[model samples]
Target: MNAFKSKTEFAQTSVFKLPHSFLNFDNFVSVMTRAHLDRAYWNTLLIIVAAVIGNVALGTMVAYVLGRFEFRLKKLIMGTYIALSFVPMITTQVATFTVVKNLHLYNTLWAAIVLNLGTSVLQLFIYLQFLRNIPRELDEAAMMEGASLFRIYRTIIFPLLTPATATIIIIKTINIYNDMFTPYLYMPAQKLTVVSTSLMNFSSERSTEWEMMSAAILMIMVPIIVLYLFFQKYVFAGIVNGAVK
Candidate 1:
């Protein structure tokens, strides 16, 4: 019951060393300095933007088609998508490399982006579900005004899909940012490494650099954590809006 007592009694562990440790600061300066974390930061950033925007845009378009338009074998298609959702990415890991190799995407950052965009099955479903709740009257009115399908999507539905869009972007931002396996598997070049992949390398190289690794981990995670902390309200709204309706 004594919150202050709990706070006062808390002790810093000896194992948890400070980031700017005097013991190791001078050693990593040489190797770390040459590598230049800034370059990696920019690279990671470029990959994230490419991955997130591509997935969201494509996913949204697919959702709109599935939601608004009805044709033959629609249920079968939806059912297949749902079934594919259950298949783990690991099941197709072998083929991904072959496909990437055929396109000569290996060791390149673009491979990271392309791989993620194609696998956004869950996102498409979320978009489709949200679009379903939109009134048919909206489309009818837009049609009466001579709005082409692309125009209606560009002008009408897209604006209204903002909540869903924002939600997917935030969530996918975290996913793509922290994703280590894909980049490691698809693009093994240390030069093409992202925050997650770099952290993995740092962790292994500096198995003893717990403090630096911790600092690096925090450095990579902080921005995303802060973003969610501040925008959790809207994030949840978007998720629920799409999930429920």
Candidate 2:
């Protein structure tokens, strides 16, 4: 309702009078044109594609190794991941920022992509769970057919992991779309703004354009809501399959 309302009317209208507020599309037009949301949308799409691909590849490889092969340091490596997950991200910002600067990733879209590339512990566990259900007989049969480990993974394992991959893609896309801190902190260039930060056009330290902000919020929300509604079954299936055995 506020998205269609004039600023003055939005500010003065009573909560009970919301249904009677004037409908105006000026807020939507202003946010879309003046706020430069188009560029942010494209930038976010690039980051999401890169980040999700990296995550799926890296997570699958790690899960393949840990699930299929026996290694001396396997427990230690997993323990490290679990331990690090407990550390609050805010507590490590200084070190993380310095590393990003050292690698010269700061202020670039690569910074967001690289930072988000690594698989989280939860992702690792989910992938591992799926790997566990895959039969060793399949690997053995592939090996008998002169298939290398890489071939087995690419043609055999990857195809079977599609459900889990879909779940991860949906979840990761939503996360990257909604994330503001990474882009705001590392990529401060006005041209690098993402959808999460584009709403700042309606905000100032002194006061905010509530009507425009409402419209912007709606714009930002629709994609994620639609995405989840379409793919929610995969998410539930992945979680249940990963947890059951």
Candidate 3:
């Protein structure tokens, strides 16, 4: 009966064998087909798009003001933004819930977009610094040629700023794509999820399914990586934009 008792103890141990859950290609396809890709992946793409557009537009404008023109309170305003950059992100997490609720944006795709769209102080500062590197002589020449401010910006300033803008867009896209917490708090409802939050759900329902998780994570990561790879040159130029001249 010793052998029988040995088997009984083995079965009773924490390491006791249980039915293995196998993940094969068929299971993967089934999961992929069933997974809510639209709610998460597409929503993330939309948010990233909105954030980049808004940031690029507003950031360029702010950079123009700070870099090209001068006025009262300019230093104060720019300094305030720079100071705000130091405030830890954790401090805002608890407060944004109420603001988001008042705005009635929670659990919506707009919630993600709106939350992400505001000017990033760092991006603004980077763009502003880059703008400073652009020679004022270019603007003077444009004005001498009777070029309008808008035309000058469109033809000269904007083109010259391409390196910074592309780099900023790429950086912002990766940032928004990877940002999970803001969406988690502001878009708590599963119906309007993004990749970051969806990844969590994918993890929960398929905790034992690493292959699927790996695939899902890879899917979320690959596009951003590819974008950065494609624009690697601009990324370098952006980094060096203000270093010379």
Candidate 4:
């Protein structure tokens, strides 16, 4: 409702009544025209796509190798992952920033993409959980038919992980979309703005344009809300299924 209010109306009071102009799109217009959200949208989309793909490929591969095969130090690796996950990410930002700087990824979209590209323990655990339910008989049967390990993974394993993949994609997309810290810290350029940082346009050292800011907030929120509303069932199902076994 604040999105439809004039500056004066918005400044006056918080009322339960209707907005000053229910049909007024001026705030939305101002946000679109003045803010860099159009460019931000594309930048965000690119990062989300790259990050999701990298995560899924690497995550599934790691889970497959660990879940299907017995290897030396396997327990050590899994333990390391669990231990590292307990460390707060904030504590490592200083070192991470230096590495990104050394790699010359500062102020580039690649910085965000590369930083978010890794598979978290959550994803690994989830994939491993699903993999447990898959029968080793499938692998043996495929091997008897002359199917290579890679072919079996690509055709049989990956295809069956669709529900888990969908869950990861949606979760990762939302996380990247809502994250302002990485983009703001790594890619501060105006052209590299993302939806998370686009709303900064309506703010200033002196005062904020609450009406326009409100409109921008609504716009930024709608996509994520719509996405979750549509795919929430998959998320719930994946989590519940993984947890069950």
RMSD of each: 6.0, 1.5, 7.5, 1.3
Instruction: Sort all candidates by TM-score, best to worst.
Output: 4, 2, 1, 3
Model 2: per-residue Cα lDDT over 1-245, one tens digit each? 77877867777886345635355667788998977989989999999999999999998988888888998999998999899999998899999999999999999999999999988887777788888888999999999999999999999888888888998898789889999999999999988999999988889999988878989999889988998999999999888877754
Clashes of 2: 1
- TM of each candidate vs. truth: 0.83, 0.96, 0.79, 0.96
Among all windows of 10 consecutive residues in model 2, the one with the lowest summed lDDT is 14-23
Q: Highest lDDT among the candidates is held by which one?
A: 4
TM-score, candidate 3, is: 0.79
Candidate 3 residue pairs in backbone clash: none
Which tens-of-lDDT digit does each residue in 1-245 have in candidate 3? 11112223334544433323323244334334556766677788888888788878777877787788879989898888878889998888668778888888877877777777666676776677777778999999999999998787779887888878988887788888888888887777767777777666446643444445555666667777898899888777776663352
User: Residue by residue across 1-245, what tens digits does model 4's lDDT show?
Assistant: 88889898988968455796689998888887788778888999999999899989998999999999999989998999889999998899999999999999999999999999888888887899899888989999999999999999998999989999999999899999999999999999999999989999989999998889989999999999999999999898878876753
Local error of candidate 4 at residue 49 (angstroms): 0.6
Candidate 1 residue spans exceeding 4 A from truth: 1-13, 16-35, 119-121, 205-207
lDDT preference between candidates 1 and 2, better one: 2
Per residue, candidate 1 scores C-alpha lDDT tens digits across 55-90 of 877887778888888899778877888788888989
* Per-candidate count of clashing residue pairs (backbone under 3 Å): 0, 1, 0, 0
